[model samples]
Target: MEETNLYYKLGGQKAIRAVVEEFYRRMLEDELVNEAFRGIDMDRLRNHQTAFLSYALGGPVEYDGRTLREGHKGLNITSEQYERMIRIMNDTLRTFNVADEDRVKIEAFLRSVKPFVVGQ
Candidate 1:
């Protein structure tokens, strides 16, 4: 039997966009997380995030953006901030009613990218 990727399991691009929007909203609302986004272009970031997440979730889209480390470089993101971001992402997934198994997979993906995102 063929395995269904998380992209389709979570409904696809539209669904991913919704999750990204909600995730950003929550992030911006949080003072600590919001600082990282200061001076950044939110609209562009949102678009890139949507595409990145779609690709990460196994959608057919290609993400040609900067590597995670490069993108987050000089941000000085701390471990506490990273953990908060993870919590926010997980909460966003839960808000969208994503399956537990799928959330676990996504969490793993996030953890895998931590080295590239934090303390850059």
Candidate 2:
């Protein structure tokens, strides 16, 4: 199956949105992660995160915003921070009952974005 086809078959837009929401919720409650999100507009950040994930997961939505490196330019996000974000995302996917195959795909996609995200 094609990559995009796999995303749709795995539940498409709605499922991706759910996973993003849960991931942010976990970030908000975890003090270490919460600090990174502090002072940011939760609703706006959440929406952008959703859009980014939608495009990354092979959905039809076209992402046109700044690339992750530029978007995260001044944040100075560390490797540890990136790892925490991935961990939270994986846990959120698990909570949503995402199948292992889909989870693996998502993880690979996220990993590919890490360097850009941290401006490495």
**Candidates' C-alpha lDDT:** 0.92, 0.78
RMSD of each: 1.5, 2.1
Per-residue lDDT of 6-119 in model 2, one digit per residue for the tens?
457558777777777778889999876677776899888878888877776667788988888887877777888888888887888889887788778878887888888784
Which runs of model 2 end up more than 4 angstroms from their true locations?
1-6
User: Distance from true position, residue 61, model 2, in Å?
Assistant: 0.7
Could you give candidate 1's per-residue lDDT for residues 61-110 as a string of tens digits? 98899999999999999988999999999999999999999999999999
Summed backbone clashes in each candidate are 0, 0
Once model 1 is optimally superposed onto the true structure by TM-score, how far is the C-alpha of residue 73 displaced, in angstroms? 0.9
